[model samples]
Target: MQECDPDHLVLAIENGEFERASEILARDCQNRCVCSVSALQVTALQVAAWQGRIDLLDRLYEKGAGVNDVDKIGRCALYYAAHRGNVDVTEWLLQRGGYVDAKIGVYSCTKGIPYTSLTKACFVGRKLPLPVCWGRTPLHQAVKNNHADVVRALVEHGADVNAKDERLVTPLLLAGSATDRDDLKEMTKFVEIVKILVAAKAFVNIIHPDTGTTALHHAAMLGSAEATEILLSNGAWPMYKCKSSGSTPLHIVASTGSTETLMVLLEAMLPHNIDTRDQINRTALHRASYRGHRECVRALVEHGANLAATTKTGTTVVDAIFAHIPRPLAFITEILDSCVRTTNNSPLETYDNVLLAFGYLIVGFALSFAVLFHGNDQFRDFWRAVVRTVVMMMGEYEYEELFSAENGRGTFLPITSRIVFFAFIMLSSIVLINLMIGLAVNDIQGLEKEGHIRRLLKQAEFVAHLERVTSHRIFRGNWLHPRLRMLLHSRRDIPTKITLFSRENYFHHVNHLVESPSKIPADLVEALFLLATKTFHKNDNLTGKNIEIGDTKLTSILSNLEEQVRELKIHLSQFDESEIVETARIQNKACTKKTVNS
Candidate 1:
């Protein structure tokens, strides 16, 4: 028998000449095993399954062909079966211990599940179990693909209906992106899946990790009216705000151009003031107007979106929207005409009036000062009076008239008086200026002291918030970074670097400093200090401590610092004398102790 080449084998598989390929495998290639069977044979089985050749699949499976074998792309027969919706072939492969969760190609491993494949099939109106890769489960793929039967099968087979993918998007969230009728029909299956998940007590309002979007938020964002309706009917709360971005479902809907989705969201009983701003102080109205979403803008206006709302830069939504328009004046006029007519003071006009008043006051004061002391005679007289007052205040009046009679008669008297008066004027001016500057310095010092006290109070409040967040035992020794933990437990004597304080005695001493602070509330810091001290004490070398300082700990520490700073700003509002003194005393003592130790 003549040996079959790789090209012939592949051609036979592609042309569906399975009988001829089998004859070649049994006769000419019976004693010869080609590695191409693992690759080419898998492709043949996939093609057979795609062409509905059940007999071909069975014969190949019986020919000692590798069921779980992968091609160059790592896609196996089972991956093809599941992907192609060949239930019989998929079942057969699964029964043969082929990994259902087997990763496909390297590209699939990184790019995540084949959503495009499933979605395209769904668009063409095919019903098959959705294929998944990466962290996405079949349920998520089915919902994303919008395949009703596939979604149903996946859910029935115990696929996690509420399971989040790498982006933390659940199956319900994926279904919300469906736009076409085929996509919507498939999305209907997600409605049932959502119900199942809700019944299972999955968090319906849980936020996604990436965008911090909830299922309701996703539904609102994608303009999925039916999905939004289903979610509401199944007790999904639309008012639930994302924890990270702090955007509610209404905000998402109002920011979108989808009139139907917006209507569905608006009809749902959301919380009052649902169009709240996020960290950037942008309302839903701002987004709608900026995007030129006329319907969304109108909906927002009808729902009492504040037209006069301004961002941090003091630009009103109307101002921003008008500024971005190509024909600004016309659009501005149209929008202003639609606005509810009311009498209110113009902010810009008020600002101009205030600036004018300030300018007038400054010019008036300068002119009045210049006019009052224009003549040298009057100036001399004024300086003499000032000098006399200063001399009297200092008990040196005897020296005040030392130059009063330096020359004889009126001729010399005028010259002597002028010289003495000018000297007195210069001296008095210097003294008065120093006095005024001293008063100003005192005022500034008082303000600085107040600010410092406020900052301390803020630090205390931040420590309180940190204490609240790390109260759980599971979070113990896990939430703070090593540097932050070291900073929190930092002693006056130890350097900032861990390597510098890696010495057992120094580490123990620093631990004492942290423990000495009665107000330090972070358990992670305390735990880290305790563990590090104990570990280092037992073995003077600081090996393996690096592993203890995980990235999560660092992230938590940074979060605490930010939260503390914010709290300190709030604390600045309530400054007190006693609190300031106590804080100063503690800080001073800490400094003194550190200096002595160092």
Candidate 2:
């Protein structure tokens, strides 16, 4: 028998040549082994599946064509058919004893069956030479592409709606992935598909293997209020923080400034969740203020969000914004104002009081000088009286003037007059001067106690500026002319390369902008990947105390050290009297005792 080219038969099948496909299959030259000759899995049945050719599919199967054959990526003919939304062909294959969960060549030794159980345990997570399908069923493909009819057909044929792929991603979880929801329309389709899956009793809270994110997390990240509401109504727990982004649904909307979606999540979370913080101790209000979402800040404030909420650095939202915006948004004026109300004995207030005291001191000096100079002949000039009083206040007034007067003025001066003059000196030089010093010292002490709050307010103002500008670029501008790039140029908070817009306008030319890696530099990419995974451990000169090079645990350690220092400072601040001298004496005695013992 002449050898038959499987490519020709595949081409015939792809082009809808049912008779030619039948003729080629009937000849004994073609068989299941012959399908492997092509570069990809393009056997007669695989091509029929790709084109949804049910007639060619029936003939090929009858003539010994493999039904569950998979292509290069562990995807079978059933996968191809389901991916293409071929409901009839998928139904036909299902009825003809085809496996609904067929992965490419499952029974082959390449599937890792020959390994011992020990070896299996070791390499279960590691990939093999020929990878088995992540265990995704045909239903996974149908749900992914928004083919409701195909999904319904696959489900009715006993396909597992909750089938876990190798990554532990379920069909329902895959349905909610953001890779498909690129726009509002696409997001709506995903909601419809998810509704179908939920109707089929698909588990909603499956923690995905790659990110530990649940279905609600994905829906929230996708910015779909309807999908989020649907999941939440279906008893989906929205509180679980995704380990990948370190965020819940609330954090997602807050970061993106999705005001409407934010309202949806906020309504669901309600009174118990306004100040809920993430891994970094950043609340939704913190995220909103950091991004400058005034409307979100307003809503949170209305719900009585803790305006004093702090991040890991103990910085309030008002402080976070002061560095970014010249002035905070008008909506967050209340939060900014709370900066004055929140802190006690702040340095800024103390500095202001000290200035006011100096201003009042000038008036007091003028009045006292005019009164003392009133019944004297030579000291009648206001300027001369001011000069003499300033010298007397310093205890530098000359007594020689009373003893040697050229006009015989000292001979008639009374002793009782001297007593009255000395009384004025006591009040001006001793009493009021000491009182001024005491008040300034008191203000300085108050500043030492609460200076951190002023800085926090400044930081809050900086980040709040960013949030407001970002919201404006999205919500304020004309929809036909979305000024997305304006955010990058508006403030230096977000970098120039980053973008927040979900879609680009039709006329906007997105030049050589690499949205994704079209051509990956494999060696460099692999080297980078290895650099991240490679262990960087050594315990040499540091006395066997090691630290991960890129680990963030050091931040916590530093923060704890800062807190300890703060407590020590506070404890030491109370030692302002004779106790400090006593503490020094005790230290000296202890040193003497240690010296004697040595």
Candidate 3:
């Protein structure tokens, strides 16, 4: 090896010249040499670890190489080992007193590139060559490189799985967000890394301070179904809205058009949460429809997403989808068809109206044929008269056909026949036709009025179906959450004998009669109490008993509630000066006092 080239030993180890590397390190055992490679000044031990040569690594360590020696970028040999996915070297280094949670900072003043100033730049605006790997531990590097084995080894050696980089990204978040590449093997490795970290009790819900995104958010955005499932199964909350966009994981998955991932998320979500809106009051359905994600839209609709959900500005999902000019016909057709199916009754009802209209046509034909049969020879045969009336009703024949003498000698018809002909024309052409149109118009207007109610009914039907399916033996306890399963099977757990309510349950049952269950104005509370008191007094007079209000405990509770109502009235008067407020206040006071006296 050349003495002038300090990188000779490192290059020899990289090229599988382990014999030469061993000789160079053995001869220079008193001083371990460092080499400048790829703008990073790394020691020979770091090179051996990066190359995965345990023989050369052991030789360098025997020559008194520092286990925690950092390079120009502040990364140690263990960082390189983990970065290259060298599991054996990583394990050996850790066993030999290597720091497992060592953080690396890439900024240095020796590079002469405003290292301190650039480090202070925001992540969005920074235009540096290297990423901001400051504060990133060896585990972060391993997870970022998609090295599952290295990640496992580092984590086993007590690596900080939740350690964050300078950008506030943990190892789990980095692994979940590694979606720049589309390689299948890389994705598998990412899943493995995520599984290992989560198993080690990594914080799955750590939010990025800058972007307000968690590991679940990143996994949902990437559409990684396996990673998302693992995170959710490990207690990652799906309903936590991002602070920046105020969107949940469901919204992100829908916007990305990930149908499989969206299904996985839907399984973990509740029914009422399906239409949760973000900061702009836009639901996942709104995002999916706007992006023209047909499969996602179909899934959302089938899972009971509200088609009529609107934004704060009153824009609905339909309005967002149709806003595109030169409209997408297939997408528009899909949305319209879904809306009609969910919101309208069966078309069979409309068809019955049409059938009724056609029945009236037959009656008009019989009436005309009966009267005209005796006046004209054209109507002498029943079949011929039927054909003539049908043609005239369709406007295919001239009016002269009825009075002309060409077909079977009729200069003119009798007065009775003429009257029947005029009546048939009026009934068929004017009355029956307009009546059919009126029925269609009425049906359409009725659909509009009952559209919202039908949508709710469809959702209820879907819930009922889901409940029935989940109540089966196979899915009884294996599929749903424990709390939901308890709710579904609660009736089965009840005993044969009816039991009286406990003291707590009894108090809860009648608690609302004393005051409003939720926070509301004092006027409504007063009205409720007054109504209850009057009902009790009336029942006492009718039943000849004072069982409802005879107890001293009940009277004292009512009196205390009346006092609380008075205080609430005072609070309302301080902020509201409107006439309606004053009226409500006065009415509340009089009602409360009257109920107390009674």
Candidate 4:
């Protein structure tokens, strides 16, 4: 009839005193509830499970210890068993109807027991609140600890392979997570675990709730070629984009500069996705170039990644490379030179034409000056006239010399000849010289504008080049299947339809295409406008109509629910606070009586 503390049973189990623990449980089974926990808030069953004492676990369970009773952290006995890799204890708990997929913070005591009264039960039914356990299942703990046997046991017992934690990360994602230390044995163990989970049909593409990354994303970030190959082989989508980073596995691997893992992912990646952009609108090649991963950039280029692809800020791959390494090595320069020549139309060529035009103007002026000053001895010879023209062009020749008799330049010249001199000076010095300078200045100003266009052209050229390569006879049998390859390589004459919801949406897209810092083609702008105009109705027609926010059915349902809430609030307002509390108290008593009767 005396009271006994739960710590006595917990200590008995901890000390491996099976007889004393059983005696306490047998006596406490009638006098006290085994669910009563110690100062640490851990039940005796949880201690026995953690200690892998199958005998004590059975005794505590038979004496009214809930198989799924939780500790302070809401971890149940099975969770501790799985955490400790106690296979026998886990199997015993599972046999006793323990929930295998029980998460850390969930209490299963009142689960599936509708008639059970919380007031009659012990601590577990109290609903003691705790923080998030990341929704981790017993399987997550087993996988995290690398207990392959326990993982197998949990899976064999119907553990949820796709059970996600609070982060929306699946057990498979946790198993494939990267670590800072690259222990071969540790990685090998995880790879085996991944194999087992995949064999059990785990969803490989489950995205992280926050990061929107999958198992492949983490594996790529890990730079593990073996793990990447396994995931890719098991239907992992290589081009699956992350919502947070908007990066594909290829993009993730590129940032790490793992050429081997990149190659593995690239093998699984579609050719069109090789230049896929991330959240910042930069491709894997851009990421590689920015990180100064020369080998990664080289590999990507060989795989047909676009070197001309620009970031959202108008930074080309070459620009990124130069920004990271101001002066790169010879091979990087060579690679750049080859692609730059193919894409870039240098201003130097136009400058050469301007220089040639200037030369012709000088020669033409010299011939005219020679004819105009023929009567003067100084300009009698054509070559001598050329020398004078050069000096005059430099602003060194004096106008007094042209009119002075002692200089013998133009003292005896006719009025027509003097007029010719004035015309020549104005045309050659002011008009022609300034025109040349103006052309050079205009070219410099056009460079920035031309850069955006040049990138577009280069991208076009790259696509065309890829089309030609893919369609080549050499790649006929060696590359993709004939039909799939033809489908991908075939040119489309018809444009795809794009829907613009509103006038703002339409203008936003048009402005995006026409923005000064990164201008696309005018034809592209025109095409977008034409497509929108033909596909959707005019804004004028849509002006008076109210835009729907959500699904009409959902909106109607929500409105009905709001009406119900208002009615409930009005009905509740009829009763005073004390009356409502008394009603709840009576209902609780009735439920407790029913539980006691059951």
Residue 363 CA error for candidate 1 (Å)? Answer: 81
- TM-scores of the models, in the given order? 0.40, 0.48, 0.49, 0.47
What does the lDDT come to for candidate 2? 0.64
- Write candidate 3's Cα lDDT for 186-223 as tens digits: 77887788899999999988988878888888888878
Question: What local distance difference test score does each model get?
Answer: 0.55, 0.64, 0.72, 0.72
Of the candidates numbered 2 and 3, which has the greater lDDT value? 3
Looking at candidate 3, the ten consecutive residues that score lowest on lDDT are 120-129
Q: Write the per-residue lDDT of candidate 2 for residues 365-423, one digit (tens) a residue.
A: 54554554344554566676666666666786555563345633433444544554666
TM-score of structure candidate 4:
0.47
**Order of candidate numbers by lDDT, starting with the best:** 3, 4, 2, 1
Ranking of models by TM-score: 3, 2, 4, 1
Poorest lDDT segment (10 consecutive residues) of candidate 2: 494-503
Clashes of each: 5, 26, 0, 1
Error of 1 at 497 (Å): 78
Residues 316-372, candidate 1, lDDT per residue (tens digit)?
A: 878866654434445545655676675444445545655565445334433332233
Best by TM-score: 3
Better of 2 and 3 by TM-score: 3
Stretches of candidate 3 off by over 4 Å are: 1-23, 26-41, 105-131, 312-314, 323-598
